[model samples]
Target: MSTTTYPRRHLGQGDLAVSAIGLGCMGMSDFYGAAEDERSLAVLNHALDIGINFFDTADMYGVGSNERLLAPVLKARRDEVVIATKFGNVRAEDGTFVRVDGRPEYVRSACDASLLRLGLDHVDLYYQHRVDRTVPIEETVGAMAELVKAGKVRYLGLSEASPATIRRAAAVHPIAALQTEYSLWTRDVEAEILPTCRELGIGLVPYSPLGRGFLAGAMRSADVLDANDWRRQNPRFQGDNMVRNLALADAVKALATQHGATPAQLALAWLLNRGPDIVPIPGTRQIARLDENAAAATLGLDAAVLQQLDQLLAEHPVAGDRYPAAGMAMVNG
Candidate 1:
């Protein structure tokens, strides 16, 4: 396991705090493949054992199974970790996703459902998983603000929201963080979103920070993925794109050999050097992978190394868009 230790960072620009590196729970339940309940639980417990004080989840993950999965441990040590979960993605009765719902009623109902499944009175951090264009951001954030008022949630956050949308949401209430897909290959945020968050004193919680395992070199071939694995749908993992991305991974692997760190560890450590305001949530169900990701906190990244990374990224820009066109349309971008 990771023996490296670093000072913990503030959760946002507020009193809440967590380890510089946090655990992202999505892979344990959904994206990677079929959810292995036992293995996922073991990883969660292991995170606590290793001082990963930040744990993230969402209501829509596993259609509630993720929260149910975390319920027992959360109840036992609620005060020890910072729990972050999200809502807004709505699913129908038959498991068909209907649409994003930031409506006041849905917000309240979602919170109640998450609370019940988690067996908790409050969520330390609550986020709108996606910005619902049909609903005004002010209206949606107003509802989230109510949860904080009711003591059902302590902090508010927005995910995949555009710069304008983030500002609109903040106008209604102070949003503690903006959760979005950000990594070396996917840098749309560097243009405007990051600047806006900094101006508002909002932390940027980057999900899929290792480019959804693409940069980690853990996945070099598409044949290894499930037929329905989410990565299969990602453009970077498809036919020609996959071939080109593998070339990039090869270069990263070479660097890893020179640096004496795994590609996964190097990718994560590069993210650590991005900025203190940015917290990456790299998810995995294996304790070994978790330890490597967490140990990124201590990996060194001097000017020359960062320049080399920038050059590599520029030379082999990822071929396709990060998400499928359908999901891409939903991002407030």
Candidate 2:
């Protein structure tokens, strides 16, 4: 239902380009809360209708079910869309994420399986969802580079990789992007990882750019999440931390009102203003919400507005760690 067409942004140093805001498809099949297949498909179609072609999913999302879910639309429009998915984060039979695996054999098999599920011959972008410290990054990325040579993947990326790991990976292959948890609330990457990506000419793809929907004005407290919601286990959404973070959301909402935009738009607009090399993948199931997010591509924030927003976050300082202790151990590997 968007009346305006979207603008495109280049993801890496390559010719690879996508809508300014890509669609993060993980929520359609896993995480967040309960989801209906019909609703998810509707949202996917709506995204395309509104000019979103960069779709992100992971092999572990729903234990390979996410890629299966996107197969139909992708098969129909393979040439029109850019498919980006990740491997690593080994899952057990019972669906628990056990560890990261970057072995060459696993990388090959994972890419093959993901391609089969997506009904595609080659993915536009393939990423190592997490770095496996046990395996040398050189060994891992050397294998990933083979996929590109074999015509299985066009570009490579890494998520939550440390700056040193990024350099090591890029030594083997060009890392088109570094998808990490980055937003108004989670700015730790700015201190190091972001600048490294800039120097390396790798694009910054910020996942959870709306702070897992908190900055989108969707969550006010832990009580608002479904009982089975993953956010319930996340530190930022629990108890006292939730209350403190609500104030951050309130400040964003206030700025949103002043700009005549929704909180989601304001949050995403701020990211868009960060640099041309940055693109945020904000996921949602509702068509209206997708339209609102897409509109953010055109919502310009001036230096004064950006400064005010930054000041508010500096004064308030987000309350909890971005992830739980166990989850925290895996990032920036």
Candidate 3:
């Protein structure tokens, strides 16, 4: 169990409570660049020490390497932490995403494999990483509900699903949370998806709340990214888009200075103020950066500052789609 209890947020309708600011463990294994296991483990341990109990991972994160990386850490503190991992978004042995698979048999096998990797009997929350359009939402969620019924999972969630699909899934089972890319610049959910979640009483877990570290004003251009960095392929970090997006980052930096906080803190504070039903999981590989993200839970953004930040985002409207063309095809399903 954790020595320090962090502030909590409830997902969906049940009594499931997790820390308001969770740690997204994606970067610890893959995507951004190569990861040092020693450094990642330290960051994970520090997250628990500082009261971040909710840890997010996915099978495809490192083609299962990410879950393996988290296994030892979660095994030691099984009772204290809530481990959330996703299936679907299938990937090949080479780590290239192939297609989404929501077949009932695949679901069963995936959960079992994930449990093996995490060294846990049950996962706290399980999400369908992406909606498999070929399979009906009801069928997919039905298979997930079985995991809950059998004690393999405690709660169910969907990532990047459309409002209609969410409604359908909720009809089959109580959807706990919707994990989607939501940040200062990514507000597409606000129009319909967010309000729909509110009506259904489902909580929102905003992934990349710092705009993939862009809103922190630390990244100036795509040139700054290592050749292997995934952000290099992201549209918003490319050529002209990179130039325009940095302006948005500059605005956040300006607000951060006025509010006596780092740009990352200001960005997360804005998300926390959006509603109590929202939880933002900001990932970091560095121990110092982890503390900075956890501190955002305590940074309060008042109405005026929020308004200024809102206007800044509205005026700039960001430069490109949150993902590349192929990745974009998988979202809002």
Counted clashes in each candidate structure: 0, 0, 1
Residue-level lDDT tens digits of model 1 in 277-297: 878888888889888888888
Pairs that collide, model 2: none
Instruction: Name the lDDT of candidate 2.
Output: 0.90
Worst 10 residues of 3 by lDDT: 218-227
Deviating ranges (above 4 Å) for candidate 3? none
Residue lDDT tens for model 3, 209-281: 9999999898876886777899989999889998898889998898899879999999998999999999999
Task: Report every candidate's CA lDDT.
Answer: 0.85, 0.90, 0.92
The reply for model 1, stretches above 4 Å from the true place, is: 1-6
lDDT of 2 by residue, 102-162 (tens): 9999999999999999999999999999989899999989999999999999999999999
RMSD of 2: 1.5
Model 3 global lDDT (CA atoms, 0 to 1): 0.92
